[model samples]
Target: MTQAKATSGFLDQVCWNSDGLVPAIAQDFNTGQVLMLAWMNRESLALTASEGYAVYWSRSRKSLWRKGESSGFQQRVHEMRLDCDGDTVLLLVEQQGGIACHTGRSSCFYQRFSDGGWQVNLPVIQDPEAIYK
Candidate 1:
């Protein structure tokens, strides 16, 4: 097979969603805490694998979002896994700066749905304005 065909086949194994995206989850390698969930396209997945860092498809920005490019909270990948159905990507990584959520918490899933409402479970590590500065 040609090189292009080979590359295409490799990525084709992934069951991309209707928008050509896959849900990627980054988990803390040491604590097993789920750091965040993001979307990834073929290009971002390839870049993340090649660079050993978390790179995601920014749906809001409509471009590649290099983790920590602005917040200095990058994720150094330790391992990557594809789900059995090939529809999900799991990244075991060391989260730099001990922060993961854009809201300045350690994880994006910081809200607990208890008491019939969402409650804050984690405190903000750093102000987003400060981090994004």
Candidate 2:
């Protein structure tokens, strides 16, 4: 019997850490804005490419999970890139439905400190329950 071919081309080149994980940065393809940063193991990487959605490994949770799985806001991948060192991944994505952040903001980096303290740059686009439910 013929062996099945692996679709994960260049995956062997990636530099996974001692924990078998790599950092993944999600960015907006259109806006060139960074949405979020997360970690991914081999399984998450394969799942993200195959499933065509952003999947990541949660270090704290110690499991695999699809981004926005519990939320209605999903990130459809536009492109996946590897950094020069091949230790990091950049995922250009187009978010669906609503904001990407759990705080209901468009991005996690919506806060900017002015002369003194932090300030909210953008208001919450939707309620957490609305997207999470």
Per-model TM-score, in order, reads: 0.92, 0.88
User: Model 2, 25-49: lDDT tens per residue?
Assistant: 9998899878888999998988787
- List clash counts for every candidate, in order: 0, 0
Whole-model Cα lDDT of every candidate shown, in order: 0.90, 0.85
| RMSD after CA superposition, every candidate | 4.2, 4.2
lDDT of 1 by residue, 65-95 (tens): 9999999899998888899999999999999
Worst 10 contiguous positions by lDDT, candidate 1: 1-10
Name the best candidate (by TM-score): 1
